[model samples]
Target: MTLDIGTQHRDASVSGPSSDLSPSPPSSPGLVSTHAAAVSPAPARKPTTASNAASTSAILSWSDEKVKSCSSLRARKDLRRNLEVDVLQNIQKALRTSPNPFFNDPGAAAQEALRQAQIYKAWIQDQEGSSLEVAIVNDHPQGPADGCPPYDFVWVNGYVHDDTIPPSDPSELQGCDCEDDACNPATCKCFQKAVRFDTLNIYKESKQFAYNADGTLQDMMVPTYPIFECNSKCGCSSACTNRVVQKGRRVEIEFFKHQHYGWGVRARHRIKRHTFIGIYSGELVSDAEADRRAIVYEDVGSTYHFTIDPHPIKLETMRKRLASSPEGRTMTEEQLMQRVNDWTRLMDLYQAHREHKVTAKQLKEFNDRQIVEAKRKGEWSRRWQAELEAELAEWEARYREEPDNYLSLEPEDQARAEDLSLFYEDQQEANELTVDGALHGNFTRFFNHSCDPNLATWPVWIEEGSIWRPFFCFFALRNIEAGDELNFSYTSAEEVDDMVKRLNQIQVEQGTKPGTKRMKCLCGASNCRGFVFG
Candidate 1:
């Protein structure tokens, strides 16, 4: 059962003292900068009203009275071992007594308090010295469903899985060898791959990074590429300019109720363009399990499964694939040299293209260079070209008239698409994953939908070793004011419009209308569409 932690928070809504029923241990040591709300006795007061509940950082403060710092060997571990169990028992009792529906049972609210105490404390401790706080609040008028949580889940900051362990330590083994305290874009080993290729086998003349000096994404538009940050594999210190998403969220966030929208998120302070908020996280399940849950969630009137599509990551995987190419297969000096020559010509072609077309001089130079290189290699290059032509012909036959389609595809996508979805059983090649955020997630789970959004999600490769498992980090698409709700489009209205047209045409031909799931959109934006997930 999901518990709304905010509902329990309403009990401690009075502005001054914390007055928590049970005071948890003080903030963990070594994390001196990040303080847990200290608590003290408080006079009986009113529950949180809409005015004070605007931002619950003030309402939920444990105390202004500071406890002694825990710098010594005598750090307190005063919390009861059976706290979660005891809370669960109490919740069971609350459920049995309550006449309201099970979803809004008082027990649900109580369990949420314990879950928050456990989860938030652990999440804060996971990242040393992190001052980030995702405060939970509710402004919904008290009623049978007043204790309703935004969504039911055992909130977690990291992915929850039984068998899928986290990526191996990147910093210890394969990390960058640079000794400089901060990484330099000119030579940092991590940026080398990103700077060299615009896509797999495509080259660029210069390095361009989207991350600004202050750790903000400079661009908020549709991304042409995913940001590869200085990860656990980087030798640079914490201040590296390229280190943004891995540093974790930097600002204050709140999960609060909206009058119309069930639950929504907002920042307490002004957010500049492209600020890194946090990643979309949850239970990491297989594609098949995700499908099972999809049916279950829909029947239950909610959906939390965010599919992890590997299409966007196909290009990013080239760095590793290219490194170890020809390891198994044999190649002569002439063959390797020919391969290099072909790559050089490809780089030229890519660099020469502007608005998807190349200039005549550059095209002539590219063709001349390729012809010269092929002649230089003689029979070895001739054999290589014949083999490539054979391979291309075989691939083209599968697509029929769509012979050049692979040109627009990432190498990995093309490879899988060759075999078709039915044959994609190789675990590494076919990453069919879905994050069940309904049951496990951070504050990011509550972000509502909008037709015109202020936030946009960009794939970011942090320490997650698999490019397929890159984090979906949300960046501020525009400068956002304090107290404004944060949102992103679930799916574009344009896509919806196109789908509707296609579906209508199909139904007209069949003389039957098949039912489709449609969740009406209440975003109320200037460009608001009537519905979402239509």
Candidate 2:
């Protein structure tokens, strides 16, 4: 399924952190995904232009003649950095705790949040030249009234990866060898990756590169398949048309303080439909850390938490796991007939039973008479079983001594391995990750909630040979006017982002309304779904 915020009016445009807003540092080249059919293969790339068209309005209030200022000071670099980077690290080490902290008491947590906020405000001011984007405009009468902690987070425009998920080895990645130094949509291996999901060749629904020739997204792509962009590994140049999200922020965006809805992002210019906005970036934590933080964020309005579990269990995932299973090997009679020559063909079955190999249903296939006859020659059967045990023991020893040689079973064992593959499957939960943007994140985290939003989220893979771990990307659902608050639905009916649809469906089946204490939404759309139950 395709993956799929709010507020009041009347603000004279004000500047707060506008000067500090700067373009993010580019990702190291040669990182990126490939075809789904292949368990392993290669990488994906792109650049951009989002013109901030003049704001549309009849009022002069949008213009700023006076020096725009914020009463709330910028965070102190030393104190705030110590709190988030050093002190927090020391505390975590001392307590031997995880990245997330659980106060258990809301009152104490709120107090600690304020203390940290003070330090952060000064740090931001001190590090005005620090590479962070997204302007923060504080127009509230009382400095900063909203936010569990008023600030969004330390700006992280891209994912921060560590040793939680599987490593992506550069040597294993494959890139498209485009002709004439350019990618042809018809043959570009990167674009062809979409064939497993949807393809232009099928013609039922156009699943071509989402962008038009002009770089704006084609409208039909709103609910389209996951995007696979051309990357540095590809022979194609940076100008490749398939590249969009990799181009980074194409439109101007900022954090605007809304009295009722807290901090929210608004467009700085006219954003054409399908324009790449920003990424939902943060520290990539394992599933366990995400779960711990989810509980701690009970009192917060929005949990800046996004789980990367979009890829369902693929057949290859199951096949590989089964091939690596202990019971996936077998022996054949042709090789063992020397000992079972006088014995019946059932000797193969008897040996397999002794080794406890493969499935039981295969053993049950034998007729009662065949088994009785095989057992009637108990002396011969014992000799055959001993030879089978000795051979298996030798093979096991060799496999242990030389794992590389035993990676694949012998040709005679292929049939049994196929049967074992059918009986095995595994969940990709271990491959899952969650991005927590509550404390340190790009402007995207400040997007307000909306029922009918202008933006939609989808998984994008740019790190080749790493399709399983996709980047959380946001795209414009429609043309957005400059200065409008950027919004995206917190929950989607499709199993894209949150589980609100499934949760609501369960409530209907059980005849219950949403939990009474659910976070109320301020989008104020006519079709507003009432609460943020995701």
Candidate 3:
């Protein structure tokens, strides 16, 4: 049976032979169909009459609808499969081209290096002499030591020495039996021995964690802690949480020269609180050696000797008495208020001295009266007072010998052992556990002093083969933005105030510029003390 599926509007006037059983016109326009005979079984006899054509046309139309429906469904299935394949291919391409999110991006690091180079007008070297990348830019064309030392980052199990010679048979502290990845303070023997104390050695306590939960300075004003990490003798793995400072620096840092200061170090990226920065690596000298170095470095107008003492000592009897006293454990509201008032008054006096509202002599007299009051009220022990007096006497003798040098010294350096006998009275006060980086040291030596600083130094002791030695490590005190210069208060707040006052008084008396006697502070902090010494 024939089927007419073609359009009927083509060349209507053209003459053509008409068959008796011409295929019936398609029911709708533009509907093309296969022959009904091709799709179904052929008829038993061929009918050549027009009456049979209508029946054949109806059968053909039904067959044509079925064929079209099948083709449409097949096309849809093919389209869906194509789309899925395209989507999967795109995913694979992205996986190949994208960077690993877990690792630092190389392009980012390169950009940072380029930026530093442009700012410092020097080449920015990568992790050439250190495990962590440190960019050094030395633009100082005049100094005897214009460039950094050619030493790769060295991880010393103990104190850093001047020469490369290692210590012979160093003693290591005994480690604990901790099975977990990190040691539990409750069970870890090393942690059990860690010591903590307030800044003034007033209130002391042991801490399980080195830092607070959020990594900020602990609220207790306990400035220093004896850091004891899981060592080789411990059962814990290297992934232990206590294994922070030992892991070395994990952030970008740059050592660039400053106009006023010879060289200064700055953070190349935002540093988080409590993150390990770098060790103040230098010659591990004896107390006598450090003193000698300090005297020699004084000529150059700077000293890199940083004491390693975790904290000042407290008498056993005093500590026991304080611990047993109920008042020591907690303060009453009245007592707290008095302490705050006392501190506020002291700071106000310091600010007045800075503004030249008070003379250095007058300030000293007031401070001396305060000390007397503290002693009278039993805030300071008789023994401590006597020790301080004796130290003052000794410093006075030294100042008498080099009065001229004392005048020429920087205010902070002068505070080291100069005319401010009342302020720097303790011989040990100037001679605590200092990590001297004057001769041979790392980039941390370049970190300048700030009254309000962004970095804080911690004393880290690593157990060697037979001994525990100190490592001075610095950490970000707060969230430091990238390209920010790093600094730490070289002296305590009280000492800084005294230094500023002393410098101000000296400048007024000598009729000289603010920075004539010492290096002028260009720190630009709102509370900048006008001198870098403080």
Candidate 4:
């Protein structure tokens, strides 16, 4: 599904509901289908001789005015940066308490929201006085009755409710008898019900879990497990081994608008694997309600209805059955770690070269050798090579112009330069578990879709009497640096054939040009499939 929020309006339009948005089909297994809307082309108008001459004159005048305007804007933006930094620092300082004080009290939450709004108002100058208020609230903006409903933010526990059906009674809590700090799979009743993990609490049937532990799942296509954490009913401490997701967010995150993909979420600090990011909270509606809203959203090209279909137990059983086959086994954990280390070293070297700490000859030789190796492995792309070369050239020019100033950099400045690029570059759609935030959701709703997502979603179940719903929790799939946008795949397949087919059908029905019906993907991944919807 494509979420195209037009720059002209605060309201977002959806292309269609995601396949997962509806009831899961029996045949597709992990694959969920999503809808895409028809895009109509604007009619072209004939320009008269007088209009053409006048247009040319206007273009020239606008060009001159734009340059001066941009320069002045840049200066003003720089002046505001110090104040912005101070505000952010103060906010961070205030939020240094454990368990996030904002979640504990309404006053604290409002204060935080107000501070965030100030920062957002300054950053998004063009959006001042707009209805889309930038605040750290726990609830999404309420929509109309026929539209999506508002929902409160769920911290650790999951909430399940369908508007079409009568709400089910909350599930009763059944506590385990284990008295250990952390529950042992050998004796814990809750752990005994688990089919995927062994007595040691380690995944029993696959090497994928091991690879994830070593931070090597970045490039590999692996299926994620439906993680069931120790809930409040468990006789374990908060620091229990199986209590990762329930611990709440450990890293700071921000929601901001992107130049291409409307609004997006970003990390404010470096994040590690298995760390709790946030919960995908929103109104829980039935498949019928989701479909109805989806059709309404499609009229305006809005697509943000995510389905909650956990990875079926049968799928994991199938993977285990295939594990004995040659094709089923992935790289060894040691080999994966080695590859990650090699990439990190290469990036460090590149940074050194850019800083002029390494000679030009050294940089060129390393680049040439890597290019050859990458080509031999069929891992190189012309687009990436050109981008790298251009960046290097730009850096060289900047260094020559300001040698001393550029070399004397702050710690954050150095870190920013080294961590600008994303960690992964591949796409997978089948394993994605999602929640729809099209009409109403918190900051997490702004996270854009990426082929090479650095974040992964995990299911968290907290015992709340008779309520047993899975909170779709996100975590850093690998180490992610500050300033990097958080992303995840919206589709389950790497191919764009389905997306293209939908676009073509829409174009034919709308009587528009074939190629002009689809939205271009702004995700700069090398393996991007052209359009974001696929």
* Candidate with maximal TM-score: 1
Residues 278-346, candidate 1: write the lDDT tens digits: 777666655455444443332333445555543334333333333456651465433444444444344
Ranking by lDDT: 1, 2, 3, 4
Clashes of 4: 19
Q: What is the C-alpha RMSD of each candidate to the true structure, in Å?
A: 16.6, 21.4, 35.0, 23.1
Better of 1 and 4 by lDDT: 1
In order, how many clashes per candidate? 2, 27, 13, 19
RMSD of 1: 16.6
- On the 0 to 100 scale, the lDDT of residue 109 in model 1 is 43
222-311, model 3: which lDDT tens digit per residue? Answer: 334446566778898876666766655568877665545445677877887666677665445444444443333333334445544433
lDDT of each: 0.46, 0.44, 0.41, 0.39
* Candidate 3 residue spans exceeding 4 A from truth: 1-131, 137-158, 162-172, 195-207, 211-222, 312-434, 464-468, 499-517
Q: Residues 279-338, candidate 2: write the lDDT tens digits.
A: 776556554554454333422323456655443223224334434546333423222222
Deviation (Å) of 403 in candidate 2:
48
Candidate 3 residue 132 C-alpha distance from true site, Å:
3.0
- Per-residue lDDT of candidate 4, residues 410-453 (tens digit): 66655543553122111111222223344234445556666677
Write the number of the candidate with greater TM-score, choosing between 3 and 4: 3
